[model samples]
Target: MRRAIAAAMSRSKREIPHYYLEHSIDISKAQDWLQAHNAERTPEQRLLLGALLVRAAALTLKQTPELNGYYTDGRFDPSSSVHIGMAINIRGGGLVVPALLDADQASLEQLMERLKDLTGRARHGGLRSSEMSAATVTLTSLGDRGVDSVLGVIFPPQVAILGFGTPVLRPWITDTGSVEARPVLRVTLAADHRVSDGHLGARFLRELTRKLQSPESL
Candidate 1:
């Protein structure tokens, strides 16, 4: 059904219109924390950890303010809330995104509890139309799928989409200019050209990298 829809949409210029934006996030530091902390949780908790990372990004966006809202009315409205759409399985196949809004303001406990419900509804096809509609931004994971990184298309009207890939052990530079094995995940940020500039995009990645190092946010 999704393939059919995508094909049909592609036949026209404006149907499901999109633009591609690509950027990479080196998550070597964040994975080190996840590997250790993952041992403390059940499988469910580990899954929720992915959602937490997305929520953390929304928090990072909240700080920037400019990157936090949907572009509408030929103008950008700085969202007072941070709503991040989480992509999960669609009915039978493909995927759907159910949002976890205002994550920046939500307490840790609230995020966990709400995410459980959102992810559940998303997989089972019970997600409300409204939940899938009002996404200010997106955070999608392809961990189990084995993608390294994806330069995805911006879901129309939304300014950006974030894609995450599996973490694998690889060699990276140290302060000593030596090599060390680090677990790294690739992140691709796709943005609408009308909304984001090269400098703001660079700033977003810099801030996100700093958040990964904060430890507590993880």
Candidate 2:
């Protein structure tokens, strides 16, 4: 596992020119909706905010094709389907990232269930071969670990990786000129510069923020 990780990281740094973009998104609406949504469901069926983030990112990728695909053999191959690689840490050490297939097409409930199942399988060793190799893009989060923010390394072949930081309560100015404490999440995008520029990355983050602000659609 260590050897595999080292090889992938070395190749990523050696071959992919990476550019990063960060956005502090106000997820107050999303959180509120999640809380309300969870209130109506049983404990075993409740959804986490991570599910929403993945869903939003998957949908946003449809608009930004440059960030979601493989770069191999000196070319970029875009994918019509969105398979988000979810980073899951093992019990003792290391990690595995398994792709959640067709994430853009899955409902929030289904995505949550699949994410939970994937995490369990990844940690305990039941992940399939397809899930291991089918990711178009990867998503990692340190929110549970109390990290304020993270800038991730671009996984080779895949053009981009997204990092989500812990949601913090901050004073935000509203459209009506009122100061309110809102749950703000810092989202970072690390993309292969060979395939995309900063402008496209910025647009992708903005689109994600817009989707997160209105979580009902996810």
Best by lDDT: 2
Candidate 1 has a TM-score of 0.82
TM value for model 2? 0.98
Error of 1 at 170 (Å): 1.5
Task: Estimate, for each residue in 176-201, the C-alpha lDDT of model 2 and write its tens digit.
Answer: 99999998999999999889999999
Q: How many backbone clashes does candidate 1 have?
A: 0
Relative to the true structure, how large is the alpha-carbon lDDT of every model? 0.69, 0.93
Residue runs of model 2 more than 4 Å from their true location after superposition: none
Error of 2 at 191 (Å): 0.3
lDDT of 1 by residue, 151-176 (tens): 65555556677777777777878779
Worst 10 residues of 1 by lDDT: 8-17
